[model samples]
Structure formats: structure tokens, C-alpha cells
Target: MKAMRLEAIGKLFVREVEKPVPGSEDLLVRVEACGICGTDRHLLHGEFPSTPPVTLGHEFCGIVEVVGEAVKGFKPGMRITGDPNISCGLCPQCQAGRVNLCANLKAIGISRDGGFADYVIVPQKQAFDIPLTLPPEHGAFCEPLACCLHCIDMARIKAGSSVIVLGGGVIGLLTVQLARLAGATTVILSTRQESKRRLAEELGATASFDPSEDDPIGGLAGLKGLLPGGADVVIECAGVRETVMQAPKLAKSGGTVVILGVLAQGEKVEIEPFDILFRELRLIGSFINPHTHRRAADLVASGKINVEKLISRKITLDEAPETIRNPARAGEIKVLVMAGT
Candidate 1:
């Protein structure tokens, strides 16, 4: 099997490797499609924590080529999406139903071998079944969509609520649609790329603005601004220091701010403590997908979330190493690696 192995920070390559074997309670999923995430680049650049000498692809979906004897309710030939974040059930956080904060959290792609290959092992518990009738590429979106669902749950968007989504990347675009579906009447997207701003508007953002052209705080929330007093909820998806620092300022006095972005480890940004205390704003951090993969798969299978339009391009596994090493292309959304291609 051909797999892209991350030998170490700043080193990655496509090498011929032995196929993975499934454990008693695992399923050997034949790689169909896997999306290249920003974390992949971070892992390559040592900006994110990841175990080297492993395959690095977490946002993956595939057909079950082989099912372990102990696995039940899942059979060979079934299509499924793998929830990469694996938590130790005995951990204190896991026992408290906070699996995302598990002390022994072991993500498939980050901590162990993951999809980006001909075959990858998926523990039965972490696999969510998706429709075999749907496009193979669409299944790769389940992981990202699940994460966004977590953000939406934290945001608690209500009917007629106003939203501001920072960044227009894949996560930002997906969030825009979810915010709208959650009954947010006004969903705004801010990005530096003009093309992404346009795409965001098409994806249900009530309005889209380029934050690079001017100061977002003054441009969007200034007197006689787009949202008079700021948005009811501000979701930061860019993972940039500027966006993270500006999130609270973009929120209304008592609004909610959710950090859905993955900033580099040890990164720091200046934020005003006085403003948060004075306004009584709620600032929350949303981590990996927890108990939302099934919902994400259902939404994709039922054609609720528009995953088709978010796909920017498709490449073969041989090209994945380079893709992960380089920064995302301008105005690009999701890039998928089609193993079959």
C-alpha cells in the first residue's frame, strides 16, 4: 500500500508500506477520499503536535474492506467516516462526558497511523456509517462538519440571532451554512480573499466583508456599521492571532464568542480583560468533534449541508505530501486526496 509518512517535522514522503491490520474491535477501511486540513500543514511545520513516522490524514471516509470478527453492526463493503479523536473511556474527562478533554486523548492521524493510504484502521466505536449512495468525496466532509456542529452547539445560535464568522476557509464556509440552519437570521463572514468572501455569501452568509481591506472592528461594528452594536455571536475559524484577538470585539455587549480555530501551540495574542468583564461576554473554546459525527454524516447523506461546493480540488495520494507541506492556496476551500485516482 502507498502511504504518505511524516518522518519528522519538515519531512514527509509517499512510500510503499505494508497494509494496516484491524484489531478485534476495529474495521480496516479502504481509503476512498481524505481531505487535506490546515492541521496537516501545521503538523508538517511543527506548528501542531503529531507523532512522526505515521500517516497523517484525519478527515477521511472509505468503504469497509474488512471487518474484525468482534465488530458488530458493521460489515464489509459498508461506507463510513472515521472519527479520529479517540479518548480513553477510563479517563476522568471521558467519564464526565467530556471526551474532547480526555487526558489520554489519542487522535488517529495525529497520534497514530491514519488514512492517507490504501488502508487505515478505524476502531468500531469511532466509525460512523454514511450512505453508500452518496458521492465518495462527500463522506470526507463528515469530520469537519462534525467539528462545526460542536461549534454551533457551543454558540447556541437562536432564531434571528446575528453571527460573524471570522475566516472564509473550509471551516468558515461550513460554519456559515450551519449558523444559517441553526436559525441565525444574519450571518456575516470576514476574510482577506475576495473570492472567499463571495463564496461565503453564496453559502448563506447574509453578507461578506474583507477584513484585510480595513479594520474589521471599525468596519463592521463601528457607528452606523453593518451590525449596529456588533453580532450576537462571533465564531473565529481562521486560527490567526488577529482574528482570535478581534473575536470578542466583534460580539455585542452580552454576545457569545466561540473559538473554533486551531492556533499553533504556544501561540499568544493580546486580549483586553477589562472589555470581557465589562461586557459580560461569554468566551468559549470548541475542540474536536464529540458525539456529532453521526449527525454530520446524516446531514451530508440527506443533502442538508452543501459539501459539494466546498471541494476546491482533488489530487492523488502521491501529491498529498507536497500539498500538506505547502500552505493552502488562495481562496481554496477543501482539497481532497482520492486514493482511487
Candidate 2:
């Protein structure tokens, strides 16, 4: 078997490795496709914490080649998507049903070996079965879409409400569609990239804006703007300091703001406490996918979410190391790593 190993921080290489075996409660999954996420770049750049000497891919899906003796409801040949976050069931947060906040969270790709290889061992509890009929790449999107679903749940969008999604990346684009499906009548997307802005509109954004050209908040939330008096909900998906700072200002006084972006550690932004107090706005920070992977798989399988259009390109595992090391190409949405390509 072959795997892309991160030998150390700032280093990655493709090398031959032994095929991983399933544990008592695990499944040996043959890697089909894995998406190259921003977190991979962050880990490589030391912007995010990750255990080195491990395979680096979390958003993955594949066919089960071997099932463990203790595993149930899963069999060889079944297609599944693994929720990489493995939480200790005995942790305080897990006991309270807040698994994402588990103190002993060990993500597969971040802490141990992952799906950026010929095989990955997935615990039965972390795997969600999906229809085998869908495209292989579609299954890899379950993880990201699951995270976006959590953000939508926190946003609490309502019928006829207004939504403004910051950034036009895959997360922003997916959030736009979910917001629309959640009953937000007026959905707006802000980004400097023209291609992304255009793509946002096609993906359910009622309107798109170029933040570089004008003030996104004022242009859309001002008294004379699109959704006068601000939007009912503002979701920041850009993960940039500017967008995080602008999120609150883009929301209506009593509206909500959800931070779905992943900012680098120790990053800081200036926000007005007085405004939040006076307006009574609800500001929330959304973390990784928690209890939403199943729903994400259902949505993708049902063809409700347009995962196909978001796939920018697919590359072989041999090309994955370079792809993860370099910055994403302009306007590229998602780059998938195809195992057998």
C-alpha cells in the first residue's frame, strides 16, 4: 500500500507502507477518495496542531474491504464515510452530549493514520453508511457538509429571513445552499473573487458581492442597502480576521451570527462589546462536525446538495502531497484525492 505521510511539520511525502488492518470494532476501508482541506495546509505550515508521521486526510470515503469481528451493521463492499473525530465516550462533554468538545478528541488524520492511503482503519462508531450509487467523490464531501450543517443549525435561519455568507469557498458555497434550504429568502454571498461570486449565485445565493469593490456590510445592510437594516443572520466562513470582525456588523440588531470558519490559533480581532450588548445579538462559534455526518450523507445521497459542481478537480494520490503543501489555486472549490487514479 501507498500513503502520503507527514514525516514532520512542514514535510510530506508519498511512500510505500503496510496495509492497515481493522481492529476488533473497526473496518478496513479501501480508500476511494479524500478531499484536500484547508486544515491540511494549516497542519503542514504549523498553523494547526497535528501529530506528525501520520497520513493527512480526514474528509474521506471508501469501500469497506474487511470488517472486524466485533463490528455490526457493516460488511465488506459497503461504502462508508468516516467521521474522523473520535471522542472518548466517558469524557464530561460526551456525557453531556457535546461530543465535539470531548477532552480526549483524537481525530483520525490529525492524530493517527488516515485515508490518504490505500487503506484506512475506521472505527465502526465513526463510520456512516452511504449509498454506493453516488459518485466516489461525493462521499468525501460528507465531512465538510456535516460541519456546515452544524453552522446552519446554530444560525437558526427562518422562513423569509435574510442571510449573508462571508467568503465564497466550498464552506461558504455549501452554507449558502443550506441557508436557502433552511428557509432564508434573501441569501447573499461576499467575496473578492469574481468566479466564486458567480458560482455562489448558481449555488443558491440570491445575490453576490465583491467586498474589495465596496463595503459589504454597508452595501447590503445599510438603510439604503439590499436587506435594509442588516441581515437576519450572518455566517462567517472566510476564517479571515476582517470577515470575523465584519460578521456582527452585518447582522440585524436581534439577529444571529455564526462563525463557521477556522482561524489560526492565537488570532485576534477587534470587536465592539457595546454593540453586542446594546443590540442583543447572538454570536456563536461552530466547531467540527458533531452528530451531523449522518444527515450530511443523507443529503448528498438524496441529491439535494450539489456536491458535483463544487468539485474543482480530482488528482491521484501521487499528486496529493504537492497539492496539500501549496496554496489552493484561485477559485478552486475542492480538490479530491482519488486513490486508484
Candidate 3:
């Protein structure tokens, strides 16, 4: 089997490795497609915490080749999406139903061998079934969509509510659709790329803004801006310093700001505590997909979310190391690594 191994920080390569076997409760998944995430780049640059000498792909979907004896309700030839985050059931956070914040958490691709290979092992508890009739590439979206679902849940969007999504990447674009589905009437997206801005509007953003061209904080949240008094909810999805800092200011006095982006581990950004205090704003940080993977799979299977448009490129595993090494191409949304390609 072949895998893209992160030998160490700043070291990544396509290496031939022995195939993995499933445990009593695990399934051996033949990697079909895995999406390259910003976190992959972060992991490569040591901007994020990850176990080196491991495969680096978390957003993945595949076909079941071998099922463990202890696994039930799943069989060979089934298509499924894997939830990478595994929380210790005995942890305080898990007992309180806050699994994402569990004291002991190990994620696939980050801590273990992942889907950027010919085969990856997934525990029965981590796999969600998706229809075989759907395009394999779309299955790769389930993981990211699940994370976005958590962000939407945190945003608490309501009917007629206004939302401002910072960054027009896959996360931001998916969020725009989810916000609309969540009953937000005014959905806006802000990004520097003109192509992404246009795509965001096509994907249900009521409007899009280019921060590089105009001041986003003023153009979108100003008194005379798009949303007169600011948006009801502002989601920072760019995972950059500027967008993170602008999130709170883009919200109305009583609006909510959800940080759904993943900045570098030690990256710092200054925010105004007094402003939050005065406005009574709700500022939150949304982590990875906690309990939303199943719903994300269902949404993808049902064809409600347009995962197709979000796919910018599809490449072979051989191309993955370089793709993860370099920055995303101009206006690129999501790139998937097709195993058999």
C-alpha cells in the first residue's frame, strides 16, 4: 500500500508501506477519495499539533473492503465516511456529552494512519453510511460538512436572521448554504478572491464582498453597509488573523461570533474585550465535528448541499504531498485525492 507520510514537521512524502488489518471492531476501508484540508498544510508546517510519521488526511470517504468480526450493521462493498475524532468515553467532557472537548482525544490522520493511503482503518463507531449511488468524490465532503454543521449549530441562525461568513473557502461556502438552510435570510460572504466571491454568491450567499478591494468591516457592517446594523451572526472561517479579528466587529450589539477557523497553534490575535462587554456579544470557538457526522452524511446523500461545486480539483495520491506542501492555488476551494487515480 502507498501512503502520504508526514515523517516529521516540514517533511512529507509518498512512501510505500505495509497494508493495515482491521481490529475486532474496526473496518479496513479502501481509500476512495480524501480532501486536502488547510489543516494538512498547518500540520506540514508544524502550525498545528499532529503525530508525525503518520498519514495526513482526515476528511475522507471510502468503500469498505474488509469488515471486522465485531462490527455490525456494515459490510463489504458499503460506502461510508469516517469521523476522525475519537474521544475517550470515560473522559469528563465525554460524560457530559461534550465529546469534542474530551480529555483524551485521538484523531485519524492526525494521530493515526489515515485515508491518504491505499487503505485506512476505521473503528465501527467512527463510520457513517452513505448511499453508494452518489459520486465518490462527494463522500469526501461529509467530514468537513460535519464540522461546518457544528459551526452552524453554534451560530444559532434563525429565520430572517442575517449571517456574515468570513472567507470564501470550502468551509465558508458550505456555511453559506447551511446558514440559508438554517433560515438565515441575509447571508453574506467576504473573501479576497474574486472567483470565490462569485462562487459564494452562486452557492446562496445573498451577497459577497472582497476585503482586498474594500474594507470588509466597513463595507459589510458599516451603518450604511449591506446589513444596516451588522449581521445577526458572524462566522470567521478563514482561519487567518485578520478575519478572526474582524469577526466580532462585524456582528451587531447582540449578535453572535463563532470562530470556526483553525489558526496556527501559537498564532495570536488581539481582540477588544471592552467591545464584547459593551455589546453583550456571544463569542465562541467551534472545534471539530463533535456529533454531527451522521447528519452531514445524510445531507450529502440527500443532495441538499452542493458538494460538487466546492470541489476545485481531483488529483492522485502522488500529487498530494506537493499539494499539501504549497498554498492553495488562487480561488481554489477544495482539492480531493482520489486513491485509484
Model 2, runs deviating above 4 Å: 221-225
TM-score of structure candidate 2? 0.97
Task: Highest lDDT: give the candidate number.
Answer: 3
Query: 273-333, model 2: which lDDT tens digit per residue?
Result: 9999999999999999889999999999999999899999899999999998888899899
Cα RMSD for candidates in order: 1.3, 1.3, 1.3
TM-score of each: 0.97, 0.97, 0.98
lDDT by residue for model 3 over 1-341, one digit each (tens)? 89999999999999999999999999999989999999999999999888899998999999999998999999999999999999999988899999999888999999999999999999999999998999999999999999999999988899999999998889999999999999999898988888998998888999887777766556555633577678899999999998999899889999999999999998899999999999999999999999999999999999999999999999999999999888999989999999777
The segments of candidate 1 whose C-alpha lies over 4 angstroms from its true place after superposition are 214-218, 221-225
Candidate 2 at residue 105, lDDT?
94
Candidate 1 lDDT over 64-124, as tens digits, reads 9998889998999999999999999898899999999999999988899988988999999
Pairs that collide in candidate 1 are: none
Error of 3 at 133 (Å): 0.5
TM-score of 3: 0.98
